[model samples]
Target: MNGSVFSSCLEASLQGQAILNDNGEFLFVNRAFCEHVGYTKEELLLLSIESFVIYEANEDLMKKEPIIKRGMQQKQVEKLILHGNGYLQTTLFTVTDVSDLNQGYYHVQLDKIVTTFDDVDFSMLESKLRDRDEVRLPKKILDGIKDTIITIRLDGQFLYANEAAEKLFNRSMEELLSNDFWTYLKQNNDEELLSKFYQLLAGEEYTQFEVYKKDQDEWFDVRAYRSDDQVTLYFINISNRKKMEKELKESEMNYRSLVEKSPETISVHNGKEIIYINPAGKKLFGIRSFSEGALNLSEIVVAQDQARMRENYRMLLTGKKEMTNSVYTLKRLDGKKFDAEATTTLITFKGKPAFRTILKDLSERKKVDDLIRKSDKLSVVAQLAAGVAHEIRNPLTTVKGFLQLFQKEQEVKPFYLSLVMEELERVEAIIYEYLTLAKPNVESVFSKIDIQVLLEQILTLTKAQSNMNNVTLEFEYEQVPAIYGLEKQLKQVFINLLRNAIEALTDKGTIHVRILKHPDNQVCIQVEDNGCGIPSERIDRLGEPFYSTKEKGTGLGLMVCYKIIEHHNGVLNIYSEAGKGTTLEVILPASN
Candidate 1:
């Protein structure tokens, strides 16, 4: 029957009646039963039948439970029931297995309340009434459970076994119960299991551990709880969980192996300390391991870039940024500094927010780049040699002619001496300008520069080259603010622009150069050449490495010029038309 119809039938009964699960928990209680227990249906439903039974009677009832569970019904059993108001009554009950009505329910009928102890004979009532047709409700419930359950006596004799236990051991209930618990452990050669069972038997109250069943090839998480006379064990299968754990462990190991063997230096760090560093990172830092002490992030990064690195790392860990790319100078454990480009990204490390940084060593790359810049600088200087010689030769020839005239007269005239001195000073200026380009300066300091004056000096240096190309150089300017930049680098940029302008011309052409203050506190410099103009599409590729308009040009010179200008936080743009001249404009932020 469904729960409602069964509950209604029990509720309509005049005598005290209750339905209980195999564990003696009340599933349904009639009005008569509620009155007998002095509890509401709601209150009694929350309790078990034993909750009202006195200790001595409960123990006596528990003794008959095994017989009742084996399809025997106890009739007219005398038990003392304690009321909620601190009173006890002698009641007679008849408990019948009702598992046919429900899977694991027992029907208990309150036969009568006895006024005197002499009314019933205890000897005949204590005898169990055997009914072979009685439902074995407890066995059905225990067998329905997924986990293996067993009850064993203190002397290691197995008393009860569930279907799960029988299935787990691949034996029948009769066979499983026939074997003692200690004998099972001994037969399996499980000394650990035997010891744990011994611990439970020796007043341990509770013990739990995992055991692998070799014959079954499965893992079981076992828990045992002890009582005065018996210990109950529960074995929960954990084979799937164990297999997944193994796979996850292997995955983690594989991931760590991949990161450890990476060619680039890979490091994971929280804000305060480095959590992990790969072999490449260790080698780059000149350390065998981090066993020396906590490796603070500041210890490896150079002081100048540390603040920037910290900010970027914080943003990554906070999820404020996805990733950051920057070049930094890092110092090894031995204090040798090297350049590296680091990419920082956000990641979860061991279930917490952290930053992972992959550093690519830029030392060799920087060296090659330096060599290229130096090579391109020398190349430009060599090309200028002819024009510079021609420039200096003219002045030297003038001075020599004046000296020859003086030697002939054997007297130095003031006008002639002044002219000769002026020519000699012109030659000195030309040589000094030439030497500045030839000198190799690895690093330069930035400072405020007068853009107009720098341009004037560059024009003087390129004037000879322009003249040699049969080109005219025109300079125009409006008073503008100084820009903050490296003076030598700025000179290189302007010289490259002027030389390219001079070389663009096939015949006589005018190269106009102008400097002015732009609208947004910027200094604008434009170099326009009225020569064989560049094609519109090709202008975009002008500053790319190894790409040039001239047949013999390496194009590295213009690329270096672009790099220098960008380093100074400036922009270089080209505007060109096929038949028209090209204008290369540079914009630099003005100094305060």
Candidate 2:
């Protein structure tokens, strides 16, 4: 080959190589080298090698005088240079003598071995150089990261720790590096974590584990990635999330305990399918265990109520209505019926839509209510007896007087006449009671009655009794709707209530009667007395027949009053506090 051909081949091979004289000035560089460093051929020739040493590493390179002396004597040297964009690069050069005796001229040949001219493109070479520069970059970048990053050796010793790691562990990087990484763990004695760490050191690529930080005494989730011989651990504090989970578990447990302990039957269901049931529910349904599919809500609910239950479910699912509290009649497993009050709510169970219901058995309450009803009936019967007595006593008195006058002759047998009069008086009293019970002519005289006037008349009639007891009578009447009823029957009711109030008062006690219209447009007559009130236990029995507190009370008085009020389509409500007072309120619907 010709000399020109050889020169061209050599020059092409040195395209990315560069050389610099011992004076720190670039003497020659191939086209590829000039472009890789982001400089033109002329610019490379003018530039000094030290200019590309990177400002920070320049002093270190200057201190190494042996490297410069060796390169000058041997005519070959290898050194790292900083590119224009602050990157380090490795370069090899072959230098020639350029002393003054040689007429200020020099010749040199250079090459790049690690990054060859053909293999190293300008962009790729720059990128590789940048990566090398980054290896020596300061750790300030890690300070801005939120997550804690730590590097540990195979011996469980911390090699490096970032600012976040320092804050989280409450230790300085120097302190962390000096201590064993396990020593900073709150539960350093935990065998499980140690085992996991052992597994991690045994070449396990990625592993997740929980460790407690001693500084905060809180748990953290650590995800580790192992590369080469070092392990990189990323830590995230999840204490708050764990605490919330614990609280939710406790709340659920408390709710379950309440359901299990309650006397009322309770069950949770999704529509007609039962998802969960309490012990009470099982007992109420006569089920041995809820595990049996037969004990589901669909099976327990009566056929008649099924449709209604489905409708309610539809309403709840569609968001048109919410689960409501309601009273419903349920059929028991034995085919008997019972009343229940159910409170329902929408809930998510096991990540699926569901409804929970709490049921309360109302059987005992119903029984008590029935007893009250019976007592009311007896009260009415007693009122009728009193009314009969009032109507028949007058005729009985006339008969007795006439018989006494007839017996005045003394000619007839005195014993027989006396016996006949006695029997006649007894028969007349019985007839009087019968008349009262019949309530004859009471309802027949229906008329619009002013409650205010009626109350006043009753008060007038009881004035003598009030005076005997030294009780003061007071009246508070408001303009109210008139009530249609038998005036005489109503009068009797008012009299009975007023008399009871007056009798209860001690000396100087007050009796107050109030007349007003209720919210339902009904007349309300309230007679209150400041006297010794009945005990709570005895109040329920007040309207029953033959139940009385007074020694002379026949128990028929209040009963008679209750009957008359009922006949007039009214209700009597009584309120009393022991040693305080008693109040009676009579409510009658307004006349059309």
Which residue ranges in model 2 land beyond 4 Å of their true spot? 1-142, 157-159, 178-192, 291-294, 318-337, 348-353, 378-592
> Model 1 scores what on Cα lDDT?
0.76
Going through the candidates in the order shown, the clash numbers are 0, 7
Clashes of 1: 0
Cα lDDT tens digits, model 1, 1-592, are 7978977887899989987788778888889988876778987776667655543422544355331242536645676655543345687888887676547767788877874334555333222101111113324355678999987778777666777887887778667766777777777798878878778766899999999888889999999988677788899999999999999999989998999899999988886688888898889898875752379878887655664566566556666468988888888889998889999888888898877889999988889999998879978667666666666787789898998998999999999899989989877755654454344344677788999989999999988888888898889999998888889878988998888888888788999999977655678899998877888778758876447898745465787777777666566768777768889988787886
Q: TM-score for each prediction? A: 0.48, 0.41
User: What clash pairs does model 2 have?
Assistant: 383-559, 383-560, 384-436, 384-437, 387-436, 388-435, 388-436
C-alpha RMSD between model 1 and the true structure:
16.4
Task: Flag clash pairs in model 1.
Answer: none
- TM-score for candidate 1, please give it: 0.48
lDDT of 2 at 174: 65
Tens digits of per-residue lDDT, candidate 2, 71-116, equal 1443666655555433456666555554454333334454553442
Residue 412, candidate 2: alpha-carbon lDDT:
57
Q: Quote the lDDT for 19 in model 2.
A: 47
- In order, what lDDT does every prediction score? 0.76, 0.68
